[model samples]
Target: MSSIHPLSMASPYIRIAHDFHTEENMRIGPTRIVDHALHYFKEGDGVYTVGNRPTTIKAGSLFLIRPGVPFSFSASPGTRFHMYNLHFDLIEQEDSAAITFPYPKQGEPQRVPLPCCLPDEQEMPVSGLPSSVPLVETATYEQLFFRILQRFGQPNTIALLQSKSAMLELLALLLRQTENQHASSTSDGTYETHLSHAVAFIQSRLHEPISLDDIAKAAQMSKSYLLKCFRNIYRLSPIKFVMKQRIERAKCELLYTSKPIKTIAGETGFDSIHSFYHTFQREVGTSPGAYRALAHSTALQQEEPE
Candidate 1:
């Protein structure tokens, strides 16, 4: 699993939430869903079919089904099953809570959601998230699932808010798992050597226009492979990584030097003063001059004896 930075969105609006303890010989749809869904198998002996892919359900199998995907559930011969099922919208709409989906139908066509990704300005390079995550410690996840189910099974505003908060926490936990996996992958000697080379190249070229090709060449890999490496390790593209390095260098120059804003901008490889100001404001939440002034004020206050 690759690392994924929390992308732009508020807490999800949960639509349907339930804990299902199945009866004997049970089988359910080939249902096409219109909202995102999470089916956490707490203790199940079953097979979950999503699109054309099918996976066996274990004690801690989590199926993350995006909107418009066809899925079905079947019990493993004579075995009863138990799962926590949740349907939600990635972002809330005014009428989200009022909407309800139709019953599952067979042979429902699949519909794809707009791609979710990081690197705000870039086109979506990430195609799809993992369909299933086999959880290691089931207790923590069970607690979250219980909280979400409990909160959403209410009739008040506070309950709604609490459910949404718990949903976000669950998503964060899943992302942290993937991030830890990616971190371990990066610890491999070859990946570390290439990543170090790539970082050194970016550090050296913070004052020059560094391109994706340049970074790939430095890392001795193809551009596509380099992108995969960066996405896995840093959860962003190589060019975005370079831009970040440039901004960091600019911040250091602003705080410690008397250079003019334009000089600093040019030295940090920004195309123009306007571009520098825009990127600086977006990344640092302040204009270059304002940040420098604030840093200067802090330094002066610190230098004064208490």
Candidate 2:
């Protein structure tokens, strides 16, 4: 299995460099990268070989290439590949380490810090991720990439900070997606196969309206059976899973974009601004505008020179 590093809890300095490329018959590396990379293919097809594992790459595929992983890729003949790529380093301070928080009472909230790095036994299943994983082309994902491109175009201290925050959000999204994929693949028997299909369907149509019947049909199962399988694997009904995905996309937009709340609502498939407001408040415990403001303020403060 490939090694994996967890994101740091402290204010790890993240540096981002990115580009968009369109080309035919291009070949790159059997080399190792010094920093982590996230590559999004917007068009065409290719092959990415990591170590001895070769994974097919196509449009809408996202590849997470880790540092020190030997990988290489080339576009198929007569086809042009359009791709967006990001290279970033999560630089933790030498003195930074794992931290813990304790509550005095049982009823009070506990706010333990996440580990700065994962132990070997706790590393995520990197074999499940391979070199390329397909992702839904949600509005929020596209917006994040575009915004990263925009920030790179106009370099500044604040833009650099915003770009890092956006990159971190993208990494977090990929991690969640990878975990879900791993879970579905590792389940038993036809349960695994059916759940994988259902997950792919939901991810591919995250921005569009998806009914339980549609998901059931996609998985080639009856609605009731699909519900049971989905709940057993995910502990949530298909509809609720869809809502959770929409909320996640909304949070990304809230953090990264300056788009109006109504526009973000429409893009994320909320029926109305009121519904978006209420859902955001219920799920996040804050309004969308306030959340964005706080995120921006915190990012700027952290990125400020010490």
Candidate 3:
């Protein structure tokens, strides 16, 4: 993990929020998630599942699941952890109707919502973990996440954008690392021009509304295939990637300009300010004004000690 590197140090989407782990406490606890769940886990071993089937989570791990997929597991005894529970409200949008707010010539296949999809019986099995944790050394994967979360104490466009970009990069790095771990072998390949083009297209239009289809088309791939590949590479859905970019750019106006929040929302490809506010709050953990004030005060304090 230490040798892992990224081509883009400046990704516009998918970023960290906050990351912290217990330094002293070495014990673990059990948790029950509601219908839908999104969370992060680090520095422990655990098994999670929708019900019966389980997947092992190790150090430097993050998990996000919808209603049907339930994660249930416990970490190794004496293992430390830094974790988060993330719940996304707009994840249920139907796939058939593409979100038409931004990004040109984009379309998505209809998605069927399985409200009652649960794990069937007969998949449960308890496994005794190793007496000690594995030699699972990891890099500073959570540093950007910690920074993003810490930014909630200060409000401003620069910090917000920085956090958003860092989050995107961190998520991509995570997917790459996880995939690499699961591979039986490795393939050495160069980058694709089309993938680069698609990324360029997204970055070029960061301030504009862009759709998943638009990105896929730019990459010369179908919606489903592009989404699969993109997630493999970026650890985020296309729409989500676009939204992260928009929100990142919006932070620019939020910090430097005096424009109304509604205007900022509109300019950033949001349907309305209320929608923007909700999304912003979800990502940053604070209201826009509150963030701005926090950032301003922090800047003042840094410049002139109180």
1-306: candidate 2 lDDT, tens digit per residue: 934354534233343445457667888878765445667777779888877778888767777676556788889997778877765545543422221121123464432332133221124454234456546434446667755655553435776676667766765565555565565564455766777688778877776789998999999999998887767656789998888778877877777668898998988778899999998899889998898888677656654555
* Model 1 regions more than 4 Å off: 1-7, 102-128, 186-306
TM-score of 1: 0.51
Give the Cα RMSD of candidate 3: 19.0
What does candidate 1's lDDT look like per residue over 36-63, in tens digits?
A: 7888876767898978989998766888
**Model 2: pairs clashing at backbone N, Cα or C within 3 Å:** none
- Candidate of highest TM-score: 2
| TM-score, per-candidate, Cα-based | 0.51, 0.63, 0.40
Top-down TM-score ranking: 2, 1, 3
lDDT minimum window of 10 residues, candidate 2:
95-104
Q: Can you rank all candidates by lDDT, best first? A: 1, 2, 3
lDDT of 3 by residue, 1-306 (tens): 433222233233222233456543343223332233335675566555534545677654555543434335565556656675333222223331232211112254323443222121122111111111111112223444444555533446666566556555554554444443333122543224455566667766765778777888787877887776667755778788677767766665676568888888888788878899999999889988887787667556544423
Candidate 2: residue 265 Cα off by (Å): 1.8
The C-alpha stretches of model 3 lying farther than 4 A from their native spots are: 1-191
RMSD values, in order shown: 17.1, 11.3, 19.0
The window of 10 residues in a row where model 3 has the poorest summed lDDT is 124-133
lDDT of 1 at 7: 44
